[model samples]
Target: MSDMPPKLAEIVDEFASAPREVVLEMLLEFSDEMPVLPAELRGHEGMEQVPECQTQFFLRAEVQTDQTVTTWFDCPPEAPTTRAFAGILAEGLAGATASEILAVPDDLYNRMGLATAISPLRLRGGTAILGRLKRQVQEQTGTPT
Candidate 1:
């Protein structure tokens, strides 16, 4: 059975606050047809590869939000479903160290911070601001050396 476009539109109306243009545009524009490949008479093949195709709408909406948009755009593929993100300003300056966090380029720092906020269930959450201390510790250093 196929889902009509209007039915999908109804779903979007339900979640009025979400970026509807991005998600709906992606779903409606998706094409289910696959390119036909000739039968191969060779040794056993374990699996057929699925095509990797995603619309630019999601990326465009995210990029357009710009430097002022201090939010994470993507969701983690794995579970522990929900996320909690707070503004960088909201995090407060208490345990933050200037030397480690400030040294990284502004863009990388932003990305790390976003990733951390979006996946607080992961150990790497808001701590992304602490660049060096977050790394895996080595046997010799007992720190992320």
Candidate 2:
């Protein structure tokens, strides 16, 4: 995580050190803390859908003129795991630059020790979320992957 954004690295460290039971509980907490989508994006029609997730999940990421990233995510409250994944990215990667977001390792969820707490499919979905987010940042910023 040496190349990861500072805030994102911090979150990863926190999860990496947590016990399995605590990881699940902390994941739920992240779900609860996820920000609501802005009114303009509430429709979800323009957002990218994360089909890997069991529940409906949509996200949009914008790399701003100032180089800070702003992301939006939409997922049902009942889908705690998926929502947690979205929340973690939304909060952790907030204000990161394209390079910082892209530098995040592909196996980040696993490195966070999430593999033990969540099902493999759920972990895959979380990985997909980060992958898609990074792709968007790359596409928008014209940064080479």
Clashes (N, CA, C under 3 Å) per candidate: 0, 0
1-145: candidate 1 lDDT, tens digit per residue: 0221232223324333335355333222221111112243122132211111121100001111221111121212222111111122112211323222233232332332333223332323323322221221121123233
Task: Give candidate 2's TM-score.
Answer: 0.96
TM-score of each: 0.17, 0.96
The TM-score obtained by model 1 is 0.17
lDDT of each: 0.24, 0.90
Highest TM-score scorer:
2
The residue-by-residue lDDT of candidate 2 on 1-145, one tens digit each, is: 6779898899999999999989989999999999999898999967999888899999888888988888999999999999999889888888888788899999999999998888999989999988898899899999887
